[model samples]
Target: MTTTPALLPPDIRVFERGWLSSNNVLCLGEQATVIDTGHVKHASETAHRVGAALRGQPLADIAHTHLHSDHCGGTAALQAAHPDARVWVPEPSLPHVQAWDEDRLTFGDTAQRCARFNAQHALVPGQSVRLGARDWQIHAAPGHDALAVLLFEPEHGLLISGDALWEHGVGVIFPQIDGSDDFDTFNDTLALIERLDPRVVIPGHGTPFGRADGGIEAAMARSRARIEQFKAQPAQHALYAAKVLIKYQMLDVEAMPHAEFQRWLDGTRTLHQLHQLHRPDLDWPAWLALVLAPLFGKGVLRRDETLVLDGA
Candidate 1:
């Protein structure tokens, strides 16, 4: 975990992982707790880190902000390591997690992976939970993911913001790809954050940002502007979403044969849904070309006759 003493409370330790995985927040307390394990690819490392941090103490709970693959993929691994650690997920997603339904969880549709795990409890909004001697109020954060929740520690003005609020912007509005107009909900979540007025924010994927870095208000303003841009040019947002999916795949594989990557792209339902909804005039091949154009142009990725390589 990186040490950013000025931005974080003494009890919280943040693992600032990059794009492929969500940051892991380790809360030190009498009852040890780990919030948001990273991607499956980093499961072993995550468990090792948590175990080292525990210094032989048993992990009491493993909680998630949401059930997105990157955010919760390491849950199964952690559960295996600490059999008694209770796994908790958002209330709305408890049933799906209990059933281990990849389809219902959107893992299958997004072409992402999350090993099955059991949830022993739900993180419902309007509730409070204790971690590391601090009481955190759980609030529903519904823009990036409808079922997502944020943990706010009022005493220190600390917020554990998942993908719902990031330094740059929020995560891709996933429901949009599935034919849902959730932009308004996303804005509402932003408003909720404003009301919370946190002193420091621990985001899912980046370094913690707070009053020193243009403050939370500045971040909110940037995100609001981005939302308006997407609203005005819905097609642009679709194209951005397409690029994100492709880039995520690239990050997962690092490099893949062009044919294999194409097959995977063809199999991902979200990409097809985005294309059909936004650019139906073009045939599949032409639409794909359009999606790949900027990705290749800006060196976010590179591909030759035989392979696709991650350049970003």
Candidate 2:
């Protein structure tokens, strides 16, 4: 595994990994806390690394910005290793954690994506928690997920923004993609983050970045541009869907046959494109024509008068 350099001052350490996992932060003080553990696949390694960083300081708490599998996957392992550690999670997600809903939590489908963890305390917005000697403020950030929240240290001007914000974009505006997302809610949440005016941001997935030198503004601009582009072209949504599937499946496009690809799409919600385009009444041929025609014309998919993998 490639190692990410320590980005924060001596007090804070970051364990940066790839997309399947989030960067973990170790906040050292009288009471040490870890923010957002990596996915379950990497939980053991993450714990080891975090243990080394603690250097005998008890890991007093394990906190999460949201309930996403990747962000809290390692919580169980870390807590198990450090039996005295208290696990903190957003108040809205507390019920989900208590019930441990495998299906509702989407854990059954993404087991490889996250590790299981137990919640010991609920962290609410406007609430304050003492980490070391400093008090960190919790703010509700509900765009990425309705339960998502962020951490802000007013004195340090540092923000631990989970999937709510990223260097290039935000988390999959899940509600939008799932056809149940509320754009208005997402916009309101974005505005809330903008108002925070954080000097430094430690996102859920990327390297720690500064608000200075136009970093935050640039990221916000990129997010706005993506929102506009997505609104203009619905197919961009499908493209992202495919990208996510590829990442989740870890499939090599070159090795997949056209028939297999079609089966995969059929089994997944991609088949719902017919409903999305308001052509639900169309027959299979008509639906295939409606769906594949534009993609072929756009050179995204190639068909030699037969459903063969492009370039095959």
Candidate 3:
């Protein structure tokens, strides 16, 4: 049976289903280039899809906006499939890629998050790449990650924003972990992007959007609001951590036991320490109290003398 070919958009084709693992795009031309590959779990499939999209044309280059696992995980697989293809990455990420530093890549405690990929080329600001005969400009987009870069096609007024600008806010500003949340820097980057006047924006997550609609503005506003909320209650940091883990695991809350869930919370470094320090205000002995409150209200967990997964 023949598999359906990856979706294409005139000269620019987008594989839009991978939001959590940002969508992939293939630009068909004299020099075929693919913008960002999905997660490692989907790497093989992505390579196959890209190969099919090539349609006998050689894949000259593979470029990544950043080194995030979701953004570059499939690089190795793609290269293995097309041995002639050269991997292109941001200049800052070059050293890490060369040294093969898995730790520096921030693939969580598990290396499973990202696969090893070699960078044969570097994309610096002002550098131009010819995709299907038109030149696309590369710009440094730092804030989410200091090494991140964004691609802009001035002729077509198209921007492959990557994680710098998502449909519903930007990617997590990871620099905050080191106490360097320069909101000003992020704002500057956004302003710089606005000046480009991109007619169409292909974000790292969500659908491709037009600048006319209030989508970009709404996302920026939500990002600012979240930053303010993050500053207000530090406990929200722990909550944010929980939310990320939950989304990653996609756990069926109803199948979780209260005690087991509490144990999971206790195992987390931030959550455990936060519970201990704020014992007076939060009451640690009743640790399961706050933990279950939200889930219980959401009908994800039920409490009947003892906590149990709601549906289970």
Name the best candidate (by TM-score).
1
Ranking by TM-score: 1, 2, 3
Go through the candidates in order and give each one's C-alpha lDDT.
0.87, 0.70, 0.69
Residue-level error in angstroms, candidate 1, position 192: 0.4
Q: What digit string (tens of lDDT, one per residue) describes model 3 on residues 1-312?
A: 121223224778778744446588788788788889987767888888888888878888889988887789788999898888888899877888988887677654322267787887888887887755468899998877777889998876888888888767545555544345554566667877888878777877677776567666676677667666655654565455444444333222334455776565555443454454334366665764665467567754455656554432
Give the C-alpha lDDT of model 3.
Answer: 0.69
lDDT by residue (6-54, candidate 2, tens digit) is 4355777777877767888788888898988877777888899889888
lDDT-best of 2 and 3: 2
Error of 2 at 290 (Å): 11
| Per-model TM-score on C-alpha atoms | 0.96, 0.79, 0.77
Model 3, position 307, has a per-residue lDDT of 51
Specify the poorest-scoring 10-residue window by lDDT in model 1.
1-10
For model 1, how does the per-residue alpha-carbon lDDT over 1-312 read when each residue is reduced to its tens digit? 575677886778998888788999988888788899999988998988889888999898888999888999889999999999988888989999999889889898999888889997989899998866688899999878878999999988899999988888657898776766557888998899989989998889888889656767788899999999988987878888888889988887889998898899899999999898679999988999989998999999998778899996
Give each prediction's root-mean-square deviation over alpha carbons: 1.5, 5.2, 5.3
Full ranking by lDDT: 1, 2, 3
State candidate 1's TM-score. Answer: 0.96
Worst 10 residues of 2 by lDDT: 246-255
Q: Which candidate's lDDT is highest? A: 1
